[model samples]
Target: MQQQVYHSLVYHSQSIQAWEKRWFQQQNSSYGLMQQMAWAISQQLGTLFFRQKIKKIAVCCGQGNNAGDGYLVAKYLKQAGFQVEIYAAEPGSSRDLATAVQEAKQAGLQPYSQFDFQTEYEAYVDALFGIGLNRQLDSNWQDIIYGINRQNGLKISIDIPSGLGANTGQPMPVAIKADYTFTGLGFKAGLFTGQGKEYAGKIELISVIPADTELQPIAQLASHQIQLPKRQTFGHKGSYGHVLVIGGHANMGGAVIMAAEAAFAAGAGKVTIACDAKHHTAILSRAPNIMLRDINALTVEQRIALIQQVDAVCFGMGLGRDEWAKEQYQAWFDLIQNSDLEIVLDADALWFLARQPQILNSKTYATPHSGEAATLLQKGTQEIELDRVAAIHTLQQKYQGQWLLKGSGSLILEEKLYICTAGNAGMGTGGMGDVLAGMIASLKAQFKQKIHLHEIVTLHALAGDELAKNGQRGLQAQDMKHAIYQVVNR
Candidate 1:
């Protein structure tokens, strides 16, 4: 049987609008769809309210179809015997919105122009803004959102939390903090990436329309559960794959040891820790199973010979930014650029690549956090954090390789852009990226192209999540070894 997954298509806001527009052009009624959306939401809300024993509701409406959904939702709830009041924007846009206002009024609910939110209620429905918001919120809008956030109740947003960029996931000055977001039509990419994870609480798809094959998603949510084929009974050590962990200056030994340990834990058959000679004893003491090499002694011919033997190389963990480090990077990066060796550029490797500026081969995978990505793009960390999707794409475009921009919702760009939604905040600890780098190298070496980059990323995240079961607080990256072994075996 095929493994079931929690994967879903994540579309850009523009594509959502285009899909809706196309549906309307096909002779479908826009107002009818709006009503269908509001009705579906009301049904969900009604069930939730009945369970919570909530009777009083405050519906906040703006001058858009998003507000229309709110107006209709208010009308339906009032008809269902729930006490409801509307806090609406004056002179709303669209005939659909005007008709919705009329329907609410006819149903005996009066909409007030200003929303002081002084009157307490059991629930608050945020329909003030939607995916169409392109500009930043001014003081008045910010104040309103701030006020809504201050309220103590079950806060539900209609499509998206108002003020969040539909594609970027950055808040437009401010955004609504919702307990539940009853998103319309389909899933927006913003609800899953960047700051979207913080603002968009418990998301539920309303599915207000049929899926259009013509409309393509901008990204895909990576599945949580992964299935790896069981090993052949006849296979030996070489059958799995050999991974060479390549980095560790004299001053930095733990990174290489941790990475090599992770590689072995992730099922790399034969692993080598090539670092400064000073660290070989420590590595052997820590993991006697790992083979060792001296970074300071290896010549160009020796490096080439070593590269030829390994199935994959994970470079740049704890490789310092000093001149000696630069020399090693220059030698290794030049060879890897020309070879078919599967490689993961990480940590200091990403730092060097930003300066050298080379387009990597198809076999190469580069992983960088927001700060590292900022250096690579010559942009600030703020800009990179503002739009992670764009930064990863830009990295791939510039360097021409598979890229993973590490953050809350880690993005992997390969056959398609993917978001790994599994890991927790505890994975934010130091050395996590090194663990991820090792996992990438090990999996890529064993499975090659049969497994996708996104799968490897998701698997690594799953390991992190497993370790975080105890708690997210002060979780160390070195502690992920057993978790990785358990996940890969499962």
Candidate 2:
């Protein structure tokens, strides 16, 4: 069956007025304040259903309307018989702390000192700032944010965490890493890209203003949500085609392990790993459910024979650009080009193809992070960061097929482009790229018989939003595999 995904329309603004108009429409369209309040109340009620009462909650207030959100949350929690403490700013007093102070007085919540927060609270609410933040947070504020993070409790962000830039997905020098970020209006673009994904925990948008009123320009746009295709009860294993994972060197078998595991988790019917002999056992040990093969045992003819049966192939990962790995890339390239199978190139494969840009113009996708993307295009990271859309499109035009540019906000491009508004900054850890390649490969292989490149791109982007369930911090590509199943099956 073809993978199903929900895609939202994105618009670029030439002036402030244009953005304002768009913002007003989105804010009221199921993403406004009523929606946010409903979600918040529902979540709290669920906790209450389990007989877990939130006795004490902390609200970090800021100057913007986000601070207003925190104030409101604190008031509600206090009214619900929960103890509420509001932190207007840093431990010390500031002239600019007027909004927080006024809100605190009005809500009857008291300001907290650093020493006074030794007690554990049931939950923490962040209302520091929203998507409009551009400047970096100062050192003193960073210390405060760190202190709050170190505390043991359920932390919630109103609108967005303070010190987070809602546009670039980059965090301010000091950003409050929330366990859950209640976004305002429509989804903000920056929340899912760059470091934004890691800091903005489980995200849900809340539009506080009426949908019909004029609003500010959108700081960022939310990507489409992934919806899994329904399966027929009569379907068999062949319903989902085979996925071939090609990678894993002697000491780096873990690379193929991660890739294959992700593919299988994404519901690939048959996942085969053509990797180094030394690491085959490791792959099987970690994921005994997959089919692992040794590349050393297969001749070029044998490898090609196996490749012909698979619906899609994932290249790179632990495969070094040495003689053997290079030969594998060549063989894989010839096999893919010769056949009609879908392909996804990553890691060393992308690096190898970067040396020969002509080869990239195939029915394949090159999944590269900022550094890898820059290297392939012979440009600097700054250039790619400045205009991710242009850079990815340039690469797409340079080569054929689709382009999955991994970074702050992973941009998946085909005829049109998509940006994942989910995800967090904490996703900058290792092994994420390998897992992403596996996901694309699995989805492509499963739906190889149906859908076009746009569907594949849509699935990948939407799956990203689903991965935010467990929070964006320390999110490996492997984490996304589970989310894919949930989305596809949902």
Candidate 3:
């Protein structure tokens, strides 16, 4: 059995099933694995109930193997002297499940008087469905999940929550919101990414069998610890790297200022700002180190000259969606598109890319939150949120570049995939995206191949977490400057 740990591999539901099938094929009793899982779960449940002084628990069982686990858990808990009652959605359909039901009955865990579960208990065990469920739940299942969610008891889900796709992390119309989800077999991708963090709650990975050597994990949970290279004693400003941050419309100078500052905070040797001259004074006032170029005055030849001077460019912060913004976008975008400079496309850059779809180079990084992702993919925000892992992959496939889909579980897809689990709700304020754009531009320019895209993203999230330590409520993106400096130096 695998022990629960943070920052492990995440797999699809099919991989989990494949491992199970292989285990059963070796003449190992499938029923035995079911009992093993239930017993382990029952042990954990007993400890929790004992500590909480919870004596009464309602185990709601469906017709599948998941219900079999529920039935066995009720029996084990009842034997431990808890007031346990079993309620089934239907009779056990599988032979092993039926056997589990009978064994539980033999252990004296009889069915509750009310099958509809009218009576409340100290806690509730959700076993209505598992990873096998992908399609939208019908009215009956939805009603069941809804009723369970309405209950005030401590809710614990067996395996994945009912009505949630094990692959997509999407609730199928409705799903149980568990206080602790004791996921058996392995860590499912849906249980870690997308909306899985909300529904799954605290996760405990239980291994029923050893993973097959052939199975490959879809993504890795981003590590909290990040180590950066130490600065050399002989290094000067030009020895580090130069980052050019483009965008700051006549009305929106603040975006360019934030991005440029973030670049400096992330340890860029030299940072330049290319925006309207109206914003140059403000940019220099806030960050005296940042060189400025008036976006309106720069000719195409000068644009190419500027691109050549910088190792990386962070584009499209605060560039408004207007005629002037569009014209600036076209001139800069075309030059940047044809050039080999490491690029970070964000905000209005993403907007322009959506308007004029282009196959980005491998060196480019595109960061889009759910809303921006919708614009880029021509899908609704809710649709992108439904399955963020899939959305990031889609973005990468459509536009050939490193993609970061920012949300609760920030998905990163470069050559492989990664899910960032470090950020908090406090990092949700305005201008946070600008901060991230700057960080990416600065780091890519400095490190180049010395670092990975996922590492840069994790570092950004870590910076956000550090700022959130004071409090997430009023945390501003501007506050990230100090946090980034603190984290990078460490």
Candidate 4:
């Protein structure tokens, strides 16, 4: 099976349930689907045990089909000469679960309701709750989850960790933290974003349903293999579109410099920086290939003329929320309102826009982290991070343009939501967003005939991942310029 097929399409809990229903209809019984799921889990565990030499195992069983899968795993492990025990967290509630428990007992495996925290198991299986869980775990369950976390073993979750919202990826006050999560049927959207990403480590997709089963995913994970258009050998500097990067107020020249350098690295034909005059000498000394302009001295007419000359514009890296910043923002805003040039808004530009919200008509893209997104939506960062999909939709609907919510799982919302899964923790440093903003503008300028927002976002993140190959710590934004060239040229 192609892993890309599973990685690209992410379905929510509702969609997963609908797909399960389709499978149940095809199989003529829900138990048949359960049996297949059990067989898959047993097969996966068999392979894992053989490779890791895992002998002692414990399965935490709940009341639903998840527990049914656990019981079957224990049965197969026992039959294969492994020391396996079942710790029943809850009584089997549904008929399928009850039948599964009876079958496992008939297979000579006994389940204990009381948990022995001191038991030394090489691996622990979590089947307390899967996609159906919606609420916080109770005190008893929290204790068990905490105990599981304390255990020195391989912690594997069945579908999703217990106490995690299947649709939202927000965990309860406390949730199970699994080292590995084997999701069934389809990949859950919750597993790839938010707190779920931290908890659900090393995801493995278990294909229990037929490949032809129809599942409309809510979002597609950004592909790392997206290729840019080939450049002509006879093309000159003027062949590609020009990009104008406007930002870097006093003492913040590095921001716009990084942006310009990134744009140049991303294959922009001509890159210009309209920044404060204070950094002109430093910028020219470092990056002499970029064109420079004194943003403080440029009149509105000159700004509009600059905007007219460029195919794409990127704004708001280190642009302070001062009177000068407002003037620069307003000048560009007026020109953007009158022109159809591609635009990317980030950092302080987003702050100014949040102060006075308007529906933009031009081809605009907004890149806001959780805090910036919260300010735009007039909500708390916690609220925005809780359900990033909802927050992105809300921001796009209000702003009326493409929005990219930058975080661990950067989400780009244009016609559809796309989750970029390429970046690493090394990208959390400063000036990274500036590089990303410049890259988006450069790609938009070079590919004006189509919408490649998601592609640029993915490329920027993949570049960061490439740079982080050395080490995540002390990874600089400047280190990614070569990586960006490598990704775009590839």
Candidate 5:
């Protein structure tokens, strides 16, 4: 199983079967059932150097074609001199399963009825269920999953983890966590968002079907990769917009620095920080290219003088709830409300507006994590987990601007809701939101493309996933700046 770095959608039973039928007909193979699936999996796996060798494999199965995938993988592994054991709890009589069983028998591999984690295993393959799974997993299955987690080897999931809701990304009361997941046919939107990332781990898609078939459904555009605009030989400093980063109270100086540095790294022609005097000195010391000023000392005339030249602004970050900051933000919002200045609202700004509810109608971008989104919706976090789409859509409709609902499957909703198809487990860290907010603001400052907002958000997510491939820690917001540049240029 491989982890997908961006938002994508795969087959959901009906779509996959339709493609498979068309494929078999085209190939003119009479015994194409398990043979075709096995051949596809093997050929795909063979393309990865890291996955070429196998010794032992543990198989988990349910009644669907996903189980068939696991059985087929097990057969392929066994034929290649790898030891494999299959486990099924009342495997049903679906045609897919029967064919898999027949193939297993031919390969001298019989599946067992029970699972034991204590058994020494090199890797585990999840086939419990697929997108059709609706109910909470049984206790026995939970125990098996728990044991699989306790194992000391790699864990792979076929299609999806047996217990994840296909439509919603919610996991059943219990779901097996796979180190990597190989999605068949197409990508599943649910596998990229909410709690989906934690369970799916590294996701790789196996598009066994031909592309000519029109059965593939576009997954929600959650995350994506944006091509960076090229810097022609004739370009100059004014090529990108000047971004004004406003935030960073006395104790939160690092926030403004991070945002400004991120903006510069993201290709801002000029980056300015409207913050405290003390922080201003630190900003110059760390990144001398950044221009810094004290917001409080800026008289009304001076404040107005500064706002006229900037093309885009990023609010919040470490802007506290202090009366002064509140007044500044409110005034800032008032000034920009009627203007066409592109805005990226995050951190305290999001919290403040969410509390006022009535003042959230401006054409700005809002970046909020699940907890922040829950607070704005005035619902428990658990309720938001039940259906992220409804909650995000509710927020998007209530607020006039694009809503980047940040979570496992960070949703990017504008006129149409898009899911991110990229990213990895390593993205589960801090300061990422700050980096994303800066990237979006910088992009708006630089380009006014019809899809600029969508493209930037996608690039940000893909960069995070790329950084994760190295390891988890040390992936700072600053690091993503170069990565973002790379993603956009590509």
Candidate 6:
């Protein structure tokens, strides 16, 4: 048998629905596709139960096709000798659901309207709502969802976690927090970005639709194994490009130093740092390979002359909002405004851009966290986090460049949106974004033939995840340097 590889192609609800309609047209009917989906779910559940030695399961059903899937799961579980109980919510909404209820009843399964919080089960299957949910849950459903969450068991959601917006990834006031989500038909963009990552845990894509169908994907999720082209064996240091890192005001020398170090670690042929003259001695002491330029001492013409020699530039790490920082930014901004130099803007650079928006080239990359993204978009941090996709699009529209929204499931908006799936919570500390900016700049410098924004972001996150293997807490930004070297070599 050929091994199956699932691409991280994500679709919205309407797109999925349209594809399903086409699939159903090719098949016998919608019910037939539903049956195939339920069968697949049952088989998957059987394997899970066997491995965990689970005997009892509670299937939470709503008044939709998702509920019908729950009913079928109940029938299959009962037939497989597991104790199955179906808890129906808002019954008599769909004929398919009604048929499923009758069939499950025939298989000696009883449907209950109310659930006891005290009752213990091996697992709970959330089929309350799927991708079609748009409004908030009512008080009755909220109570039920709350009850399910309060239960002590493995919670699995079918298709999608109930009450999560399929496109927006916004959760209802009370949404099911699933331990595992078997997303059917296709991978929904909502399951991997923004609030979706919190609600939909351990996602497994279930292919209910045909694999060869001509369905278009709205976005792609990053893969684990990334491959970069091999460098020539006889190539000299000049074969790879040089990366210039500009940041690190007086007290914030560590930010720019870390970025410069990361750039060297990420395979930049030459790494240079332009910052306050005070940190020059300290930077050389730590990283001797990194050449230093005193931004305070150098004239604007001299800085531009130096910039002209570098392949790529990374700005804003520890770059403060002071007058000195503004002067440094202005000198470089003036030289690189119309130039095709690959630029990675981060930290205070983003704040600078927010204060005064600039016309940047297509080669520019902005790495902004929620707060910085909100500043750039003129919205609140909460608003930016609420819908990251929309925020990234808005950022791209306002500023004509690639944008990376940094957080859990970091999104890269270039020609199309690509969600990074390799990072962990341990990367939440300071200086991490600076490290990412350096890595991106280094890669951009080395691979001048094409822009690898997606690959660069994925590698950065993968390095963080590799470092997080020890534990999430106290995983420093510097710890990822070795991992970055390893990933770049791979």
Tens digit of lDDT per residue, candidate 3, span 1-490? 1122353888888888888888888999999999999999999999999999999899988888988898898988898899998988666569988998898889887775324775778899988887888678888778888888999999999998887778878889888999999999777888877778779888888776777787788998777667788889999999888999999989999988888889999999999999989988777778787898888888888988999998999999998899998988888887897888899999998998999999998889999999999999999999888778788889988998899998777888977888887788788789999999999999988889777787888888899988888788999998899999998898
Best by lDDT: 1
Query: Which one wins by TM-score: 2 or 3?
Result: 3
Best candidate, TM-score-wise? Answer: 1
Q: Which stretch of 10 consecutive residues in model 5 shows the poorest summed lDDT?
A: 1-10
lDDT (Cα atoms) of all candidates against the true structure: 0.89, 0.66, 0.87, 0.84, 0.73, 0.84
Residue-wise lDDT of candidate 2 within 23-91, one digit each (tens)? 555654322442356347435534652365567777777655555556556666666667778776442
Q: Residue 481's C-alpha lDDT in candidate 2? A: 69
| Cα error, candidate 6, residue 321 (Å) | 1.3
Alpha-carbon lDDT of model 2: 0.66
Q: For model 4, what is the C-alpha lDDT against the true structure? A: 0.84
**Cα deviation in Å at residue 26, candidate 3?**
2.2
TM-score of each: 0.95, 0.63, 0.93, 0.95, 0.81, 0.95
Q: By summed lDDT, which 10 consecutive residues of candidate 4 come out lowest?
A: 1-10
Better of 2 and 6 by TM-score: 6
Residue-by-residue lDDT tens digits, candidate 5, 235-342: 787888888888888878878787787788778899889987878777888899998888888777777777788888899988998897788787676666556778
Angstrom error of the Cα, residue 3, model 6: value is 15
Please list the residue runs of candidate 2 whose C-alpha ends up more than 4 Å from where it truly belongs after superposition: 1-51, 72-85, 89-123, 151-153, 208-311, 317-319, 323-335, 359-362, 369-371, 377-400, 405-411, 414-443, 449-490
Clashes of each: 0, 18, 0, 0, 34, 0
lDDT of 5: 0.73
What's the distance in Å from true for residue 223, model 1?
1.7
Q: Positional deviation of 367 in candidate 4, in angstroms?
A: 0.6
**How displaced is residue 242 in candidate 1, in Å?**
0.9
